[model samples]
Target: MAGVRTSLRRSAPALLIFAAIRALGLVTLILWSHAKGKDPHQLLSARWDSLWYVRVAEHGYDFTLTAPDGRVLSDMAFFPLLPWLEQGVSAISPLGFADSGLLVSALASLFAAWAIFLIGDLLHGRRVGITLVALWGMLPVGIVQSMAYSESLFVALSAWSLYWVLRQRWVAAGILASPAGLTRPVGLAVVAALWVAAACQLARRNGDWRAAANRRMVIGAVLAPLGCAGYVVWVGLERGSLFGYLDVQAEWGNGFDGGVAFAGFILDRLTGPAFLAGAGLLIGVAVAAWAYYLCVKQRQPAALLVYCGIVVGLALCASGYFGSKPRLLMPAFPLLLPPAVWVARARVGVIVAVLSAVSVGSAVYGAFWLNGSGPP
Candidate 1:
């Protein structure tokens, strides 16, 4: 109990920072919705994929949509953890599925903020941890963390999974990765990180490979892919094909294309009327590259490097919905390490003021974007 209190006290700053930023964004969204004659809560909990998640929660899988041209949009493309959470929470509470989703996401975002703090604290110190968490909340697409979406839950699981890996708690890491797999496709990154760490441990055992193959490591590795594999198998069985899950994603124009399509997208933007958007995309790419370089320079753990590398790679190489890139990349928390270190070196007042300004900007931009272009 004392340990828990200490952790909560240490994590308070980051948690408060995240909550404040999210509140600002939500308030902005409320005002924006009022001006546009839309429902604020509905905007967060009823639109887009949120509705699909609620459908899956209230009525099991098998929910799908048929486009005007007859293309089948299956809800199976979405992983199951978030909906399962919504359903479970709603079953024991009076809240509806969408409200439960929102509640879960809201609480999960705070947990994610805390997990991120733990990672940063482990990597550097408490100050850097607080800064890192604040930076995450200031991300332009940070609003997604508060929506009835799975990003928050995935991030929380991913961060804690990485934290367990850092602590060399292999079994715990793998267990966390299972839920992460159930949350997002990029959960593979967590599995790869654990596998890479285990392989490294085995490599370091000299000729005693057998000694390195401990029960914990073996069990962890075995468990890591279960959620993803199980869901894929279930979808395949229901759809009458082994590649049913892939087909579902393909129906939505999503697939891995080695960044070829993404490159073409940039080229199209460069030559199109949305030149400003293109410029922003280019800047984002440059920033990501610079952050990766910084991570390399700092010599982050191999597990982190592998995990972040895969997350960034997958998000960039995805073939559809270029606008979702920022939200998709939100799970790459290590990317914030570089900026956190830089900011932590500054005066506390400066840190708070700068983050506050950025938080405001994020809140306003998130509100405007959601009410206008929306997610994806």
Candidate 2:
């Protein structure tokens, strides 16, 4: 308990900054929504995916929506952990399902920030750790961290799982990765990270294969994919095919197309009045790719590199959901480390000034965004 308090005290600055940044975003969103005569609480806790999650919690997977085009929208397409959590929270408190989801996300975002800070500190120093958290909280889609979404939960789990993998605590890593896998489809990234890291660890072992430590490494790898695979198999059984989950996603117009669809999306934008949007997307892709390259150049651990690659690849290469790409990439927090390191090396005033500016910018953008088309 003493150790836990010490760690929390150390991470307090990062947590506080993160909370402040998110609070700014929420205040801006509330003011923006009121100005537009929209309900701020609804925007955060009851719209878009939030509604779907609440429905899944209140009901079971029995609800299916038929789109106007006659496609079946199975509630199963959403992984179950977030809805399960909403149910638990609602059953235990006065909060309704949607508000419970909001509460879950709020707590999860702070946990995610702490895990992110620890990862940065593990690789660099405390300064970099704090900067990394600040940068994550300043992301344009950072507002999503405050919404009734699973991104924060997934990131919290993924980051902690990766941290354990980095520390060579195989069983703990696997334990965390399990729930992470259940949180989002992209939890596949967490599974891959654990497996790859375990493989590397085993390869470096110059002892017997049956050693208890090696056994745990194997166990971690084996346990990593169960959550995702279990859900997928369940969906498959329910949908009457082994590929049922893929079918459901296909109906929802989402799939991995190896960037073919995304490139086409950018081209379409470039050929129209949205040229700047296309250019911005192109730059975003370039920046992400360059950051990955730097991670490689900096020799980040295999797990970190693999996890970031898979998350970003999935987000960018999805065949549809063009507008959600930014929010989708929120779990790929490792990409923020390079810039975090640079910021850490700068003067304190510069760091504070940059973080403050981006935070305010994020606040405005988040308010504008939630008030506009919003997350799909």
Candidate 3:
């Protein structure tokens, strides 16, 4: 209890910074929505994946939508944890699923921010940790952090899981990672990181792989994959095929083909009328590649590198909904560590000024976005 209190107090600054960032996004959304004659709360609490989660929470996962092309869109494609929490919260509270989800996302994002801070504080210091939280809040798609989505929950789980891995708390890491797997398909990255870290430890141990340390590692390794595997297996049985989950994803035109499909997407864009969009795609890809190179150069911990690499690989290689690439990559928080280190050394006031400006831009963009085309 004392430790928890101390940790909270230490994290207070980062939490406040996170809150301020989110508040700016919310206020911007409200003002923008007022100008456009739309409900800001509706935009945040119900739309896109937010609506899908509410459907799941209120109606359960026994729903599917079939397009005229015979493509099947099933609720099963959505992960279960966020909706499960929404259902549980709505059951007791007067709030509906949408409101419950917004509440969950809002709170989860704060926890996610704190977890990011813990990793930063451990790797660098409290200042760096605070910067990391601010940087995360300022990401272009950071507005999604406030919506009723699973990104916040998944990031929270992933960050804490990574923190536990860094602390060598094998079982605890695995325990947290289990829910992460249930939150998003990329949760596999966390599982892989834990396994890679454990394997590296065993390799370094030379012998006595069955020692206490190795035993804990073994237990964690076994536990870490359970959430993903269990869900996939259940999906398989429910759908009456071992590859049912994959098939469902394929029905939605989402698949990993070693970036072949994604490369084709970029190529198609170049051939289309949207030449500017094509240019933007290329620039985005280049930026991602450069940031990853920095991670490698920084020689981040193997667990972090493995986790980040898998997250990026999955986000970039996925075939459809190319627009979601930014939001999908949002959970790869470690990628910001390189930049956060640089920002931490600057004048605090200067850093805040820069981030505040970026925060406004992100907020304006987010409001305009949700009120228009919306997330795919």
Candidate 4:
């Protein structure tokens, strides 16, 4: 009990610091959007990518598309977890659908920060935990923390699920991962991680197969696959095609067959003075290398390695959604933990000051850039 209290007390400072950084980043984004002569409400409520999510929350699944191609795209193509939360919030509160989405995202962002701290504390120590939260809060793409998007919610769920798995709480891990599956397609990565972790535990046990722990493990194993299966079944029923969700993704130019083609597209733009394209390539490479480093040097848990590899592989090998690579990679926040732990140990004050400056400046720039240029 005393240990639990001490742990909570130590975590409190990191939690408070993360929230403050996130709030600052969010404020910068909102203010920047406002300054661009854009109506904040409209910006918040507008029919961007978020519109599909809002549609799902408000109207449920309806298979229709207005595009020239008679492609049957429905909100079912998106997982229902985030939009369901949005709809639920709006149903109960004075907030409308759009505001509800934002609210869900805001709460999810805080949850994600807390989860990141937990994972970091487990992997490294208290100081590293604080550093990890701070780094996550101040990430260059931190502006997304405030948007009516599912990234925060997904990250929060994914982080905590990983934490539970690390703590050997198989049932809890499986439960958390189920919602994660509903939240994003990457949730399968968590499922895979949990399975691998469980299998390893079972292998190491030199007992009868019907042990009490094995019974609990079997229950967890069954629950882990339900979330993704449920979503897929819903999509099939709504669209009259088992592959309907895959079709919608393809219609949106996000099919998974042309990784090389996408790489060529980026390479074609590399010769000229397209600084943005060059910068994007550099960032992509850097992120990939960093992920690899986490996999190797950090000796990350096997589950985490499998999770990161699967998601990163899918994203990199994916063809049509090349533009969304950064956003897709954003949820891989656990990969940042090893480096953050190192930074936290070496001249903590200097590292914090440097990261804080970079976070604020990059966050402000990212907000403005995203407003003017749109997602890359």
Candidate 5:
């Protein structure tokens, strides 16, 4: 208890910084929306995927929307954990389903920030840890951290799971990974991290079958895949086919096509009128690649390396939803560690000025993004 209290006390500053960043984002959004005669709360709490989560929370899985092109967008495409939390929050509070989702996101994002800070502190130090959390909140889509979405929830679970993995708490890591898998399909990244870390440890131990660490790690490996598998298998049984979940994702035009569609889209943009946008995208990809290279150069833990690799690979390589790729990679927090370390190493004033400027820019960009087409 004393140790937990001490950790929390030390974590308070980082959490405060994270909370302030989120608040700045919300205030910027509110001002921008008001000037444009739009409701900021609605944009944040009930748009795009937010509506689908609300519908599932209120009506269960008995909903589907068909597009003019005859594409079936099944609510099944959404994982259940967010809706489940939304439902529970609504049942207990005066907030409706959408509002409950916003509440869930708000709280979850804080926890996510806490876990991010812990991971950074564990690997580097308190300064890098705090900067890592700040960098996460200053992301271009950091506004989504405050929105009624599952990204925050998944990030929270996955971050803590990774922290535990770094601490070699395999059972705790697996427990968190299970709910993370329930939150989003990317939860597989967490499971992979656990499996890989365990395998690495087992190899190091040279067949220590009776060790408690090995036993717990094996149990964790067994438990980590259950949530995702159970939901997918249930969906399959409901649809009377073993590949029903894949079919559902297919109908929605989502799949892993080795980035062919993504590459083609980029090339088309480069050749077409959106040449600048294409260049910007290429630069973004290059930046992400460089960041991952830095992570490898810094010798991040096997758990973090595997987790980040899976998240980045899936986000970049997955077919369809090209526009949502940035938001999809939101959970790949480890990618920010290198920048976080740089920021930590900077002078205090420089750190403050850069983070403040970037925070405002992120806020304005987020407002513009949401006020415009928004997350589709």
Candidate 6:
């Protein structure tokens, strides 16, 4: 217990810094939303991206929208884990649906910060942990931490699963990976990482797997697929179509095929010398390259590959939901750690002060300029 308390004390400064950054970002979001004629409470409960999550929490998956072309769109299109959490919270708390969702996300964001600290500590050290958590809190899209989004929840689950895997706790790793899958499609990446790690361990012993170990691995693998599979099954039963979720995504212009087509379209537009479009493209490419560089320099090749593949694949393959690119990239947060660590090492106070200023500005822009729109 003394050792645990000591460890917590060591991490306290990082956690406090992380909390301060997120709080500033949240304040900016609230103020900007207020400026936009949106009440803070209403903004918290607004029927935008958050509405689908609330609906699922309150009512379960009962609604369906069919396009004119007979395409069936099911509420099951949204994953179940987040809503289920919201439902659980509402059941126990006096908070209404919106407040419940907000509370869940807010707590999840803090959990994500802790998880980031753990992952960074494992990969680098306590310094890196502090830097990584600070960077996550200061990201331009960091407003998602305060929103009723699943990014924070998913990150918390993924990071903890990775930590468990690193500690060789196969059963715990598997259990965490399961809900991760339910949270987002990208949870499969965590599943894949765990599977690979487990397989390597098993193979090293010449297939002389212990019964207990084998059972644990099997459970982990099973858990990983449950969330996604359960959603599909529910959609199929309710809508009479196994492809109901896909169809709904299509209507939202988010079918997966490869982002090459969308890239081509964007390129064509840039060929016409549209200054704003060109500038946007340039910024996007620069950010992507910087992320890629961090991945390479940090020697986290596997994490980099997984994040790049998912982000690029989703961006290209989805039909028309290009607006979600920012949100989709939010999960590639591990890539940010290396750069943040570098920043922290170079006069930590200066770096943090700069980040705090930027976080506040970005949060304000997200709430007001973007209207809490886009993937961010």
lDDT (tens digit, per residue) of candidate 6 on 1-376? 9965886787787778877877776676677766777776655555566888888888887876776877666576688888888888888989777788788888887777777787778778888888888777777667777778788888878877877777778788878877888988777777777777777777776766667877676677667666666766766666677786666666655676666656765677678867677568657756866876767766773533554446545644565655566667776667677686777687768876777777677666556644654343
What would the per-residue lDDT of candidate 2 be over residues 233-256, giving only the tens digit for each residue?
A: 999999899999999999999999
> Per-prediction RMSD in angstroms?
1.5, 1.1, 1.3, 2.4, 0.9, 3.0
Model 6 misplacement above 4 A: 1-7, 66-72, 211-215, 241-244, 268-274, 301-308, 315-317, 369-376
Query: How much does candidate 5 score in TM-score?
Result: 0.98
Better of 2 and 6 by lDDT: 2
lDDT (Cα, 0-100) at 369 in candidate 3: 75
- In model 2, the runs with Cα more than 4 Å from the true position are 374-376
TM-scores of all candidate predictions against the true structure: 0.96, 0.98, 0.97, 0.92, 0.98, 0.87
lDDT of 5 by residue, 42-134 (tens): 998888999999999989998889989999899999999999999999889999999999999999999999999999999999999999999
Pairing residues by index, what is the TM-score of model 2?
A: 0.98
TM-score of 3: 0.97
Give one clash count per candidate, in the order shown. 0, 0, 0, 0, 0, 7
Error of model 5, residue 112, in angstroms = 0.4
Worst 10-residue lDDT window for candidate 1 reads 206-215
Question: In model 6, where is the ten-residue run with the lowest total lDDT?
Answer: 301-310
Each model's lDDT comes to: 0.89, 0.92, 0.90, 0.78, 0.92, 0.72
Clashing pairs in 3: none
